[model samples]
Structures are given as C-alpha cells and as structure tokens.
Target: MMASALLAGSALALSACVASLAVGAAGMAARGVAGTPTNNEQAHPAAATDCSTRASHYGKVSIIDVEQRSPSKIVVWGTADDGKQRRSFECSYGTKITGFKLRPIASPR
Candidate 1:
C-alpha cells in the first residue's frame, strides 16, 4: 500500500512538472490499455502538425517525455482511432510536425 501511495505521489509531481513546462502531461493513461491506431485521414494532418491538437486527436501526448520545451519539440502518445495499437508522435507547438509512428500495445503483465 505504501509503495502504491509513493508511486501515486511521484506521478502527481511528475505531471505537475510536465504541465508547467509544456501542455498535456499524459503518461499514466498511456501506461494502461493504449488506444489503437487509425487511418482516419482527417486526424492525421492535425496530429502531425499540432501538439495539443494531436493530444486531443490521438489520445495522450507525453509532454513529460519532452526534455526541451521550446524550439526543440514535444512528443505525445495515445490510442488511435483504429483501437488496436498506440501511436506516438513528435510535433511542434502548432507549428510543424516532425514524425509519427505506431507502436504495439503493451499488455499488462
């Protein structure tokens, strides 16, 4: 029980740090059952170009994973429309998109 409490506290701290630095601090949700990938076409462009939009479009964008917030870029991940695999993307803040990729779901052990 104490271990879980400690973990929760740590997670809260981490998310707070990420939120202040960037935008969405999604990590815990991604750790669970991730969303699947989709080729909906409509969401593709926004997911590629905008970080925040991608967070809403795909699912989770790990602002916490991002080291440098500014001119560097930020990465976010979430389940896709397909509802099978998890999609990870690196995009600028409403500027330019860098990369997008789909990763296999990590089932809970």
Candidate 2:
C-alpha cells in the first residue's frame, strides 16, 4: 500500500540522516585521536570571534581581526574600549606553546 511505502521511505531517510551524523562524529573523533585541535586553534592562533576572549585577555577590547604571523607570534587588531583606532597586540603562545592566555607585553608595537 501507499502508506506502507511512505513509512518505508521515511525510515530509509531517517536511517541515512543517522548514518551521516555517525560518520561525522567518527571523523571528528578520529581527528581528536590524531592530536588535532578541535577548537580550530591550530589555524587561527590569535583569532577571537567574540568579545569574551578579548575581554578575558585584554579587558573590553573589541577584537576585529587576529592572525598568526609566525609559530610563536600572533597579532590582534581591533578598536579599544576607549575608542582608540589602532589598538593591537603581538602575543606569544606562552612558555610551553600553550595559548591559554595572553602574556604581559612591554608595549603594543
């Protein structure tokens, strides 16, 4: 019957979706097991898409762009809280290459 056919079709579609999700999850797990950064930190070392990361590090700075120029160096450019136009940062990923927090800098330039 048409109703039975429709039910079978729906079941097939659902199975496909579930299988796709499982594959995606497996791929992600493989990447993690292979020692890849899940947070996209490997690519964008100093990138901050929102204010929280900026605020946590530099306090109320509006982060616009972040680029990793070198393995140890990153440049963060954005408008500051006091409305400074060219406020920026050049930071190190820390002693062990763990970029958890921005270290103290003597100057911005």
Candidate 3:
C-alpha cells in the first residue's frame, strides 16, 4: 500500500512539472520569444538591404541571418547569387546609417 501511494505521488509531481513547462512555453510563444520569427521579419525577407547597399555589390543576394545587437546596431549575413560567396555586414545607424563594414565569410566545402 505504501508503494502504491509513492508511485501515485511521483506521477502527480511529474504531471505538475509537465504542466508548468507547457505553460511557460506557451507564454514565450505568445510573446514572440520562442525562436519564432516576428511578423515583420517574415513579411520582409530583404530588410537587411536597408542596412547596407553593399549587400548587392556581388549581384542579387539572399539574407541568411540578421542580428540586432542594439537599437542602433545590426549585423546581417548574406550570400551572393553570382559566386555563392557568403558575407557579413555590420551597420550602425544614427539619424541616418552612419557606418557599414563588410566581412567575407568562407563557405564550408
């Protein structure tokens, strides 16, 4: 009888843990912090181009990733369609775009 009670208590505790985790995950999803892209990001795939015109220097390109380091600084990763070269750009903005730097990233073989 004691063993049965212990098993029941364990099951109840496990269920409570699962429920709390589910609630936390749901809350994160609702706040757009669950690794899902925000609506603006989904709608504008080429938003990186706004940061630097050099993004198209190698011809048409596709943005791979965008990281906002702060309210005024952003980094973008992209690949050129011409030679498939991957590159990264750091952009700093003030009243206008103040700084832009390009860094070539070697692609994996």
Candidate 4:
C-alpha cells in the first residue's frame, strides 16, 4: 500500500516537473533571450515526423502504476507529431499500451 502511494506521488511530481520545464523553456524562447525555438515551433516538427521513423517511439508502462489522479491511466513519453518530446496517456482499454505493446503515433503516409 505504502509503496504504491509513493510510486503515485513520484509519478505526479515527475509529470509536473516535465510540464513546468517545457513551459519554462518556451517562455524563455518567446523572450528571444536565447533565440531558441519556442515549444510551439518544436511541437510543429514533432507532428510532422512519423513515429515509425524512430525505433524508440514506443515504450512499456505499468498499468497498475501511476499517480493517484490518473491511477488508471497509462502514460507514454516520446516524440510527438511536431517531432518534439511529448507525453500522453490512454485508458487501459483504449490500447494494450499499458501491457503487451504500445502503439505508435500515426503519420500522414
């Protein structure tokens, strides 16, 4: 019980941190301080890139593992449509993503 709680808390913290980092990086770019591409720009390329173009597009995630708020949701992190790093989760039945295999992002072939 305690272990599950800890795991859930850790997951939540990590998710929040990832979100904050992405947002912060975007904010910095918008200011043109570093002349770096903003998150929106990064997201655009990610969207264009096909998931199959990269072998590491899919990964395993524990179905029974996740933060309390999204305990039943399975999270997967990888490149998105814009070719930028992104994370998404789906319900267990939406796909076998939380178990046997994870599906890849579809591309406009």
Task: Find the candidate with the highest lDDT and give its number.
Answer: 3
Error of 2 at 4 (Å): 0.6
Give candidate 1's total backbone clashes: 8
Local accuracy by lDDT, each model:
0.50, 0.53, 0.62, 0.41
Models 1 onward score TM values of 0.29, 0.34, 0.38, 0.29
Best by TM-score: 3
- The residue pairs found clashing in candidate 1 are 35-79, 36-80, 36-83, 36-84, 36-85, 60-77, 61-76, 62-76
lDDT tens per residue, model 2, 1-109? 9999999999999999999999999999997888732333464543444323544444556555666655544445554343333234433332222343333333456
Candidate 4 all-Cα RMSD: 21.1
Clashes of 4: 10
Of 2 and 4, the candidate ranking higher by TM-score: 2
| TM-score between candidate 2 and the true structure | 0.34
How do the residues 4-63 of candidate 4 rate in per-residue lDDT, one tens digit apiece? 999999999999999999999999787787564322322322322322233234432223
Judged by whole-model lDDT over C-alpha atoms, candidate 3 comes out at 0.62
- lDDT for model 4, please: 0.41
Q: Sort by lDDT, best first.
A: 3, 2, 1, 4
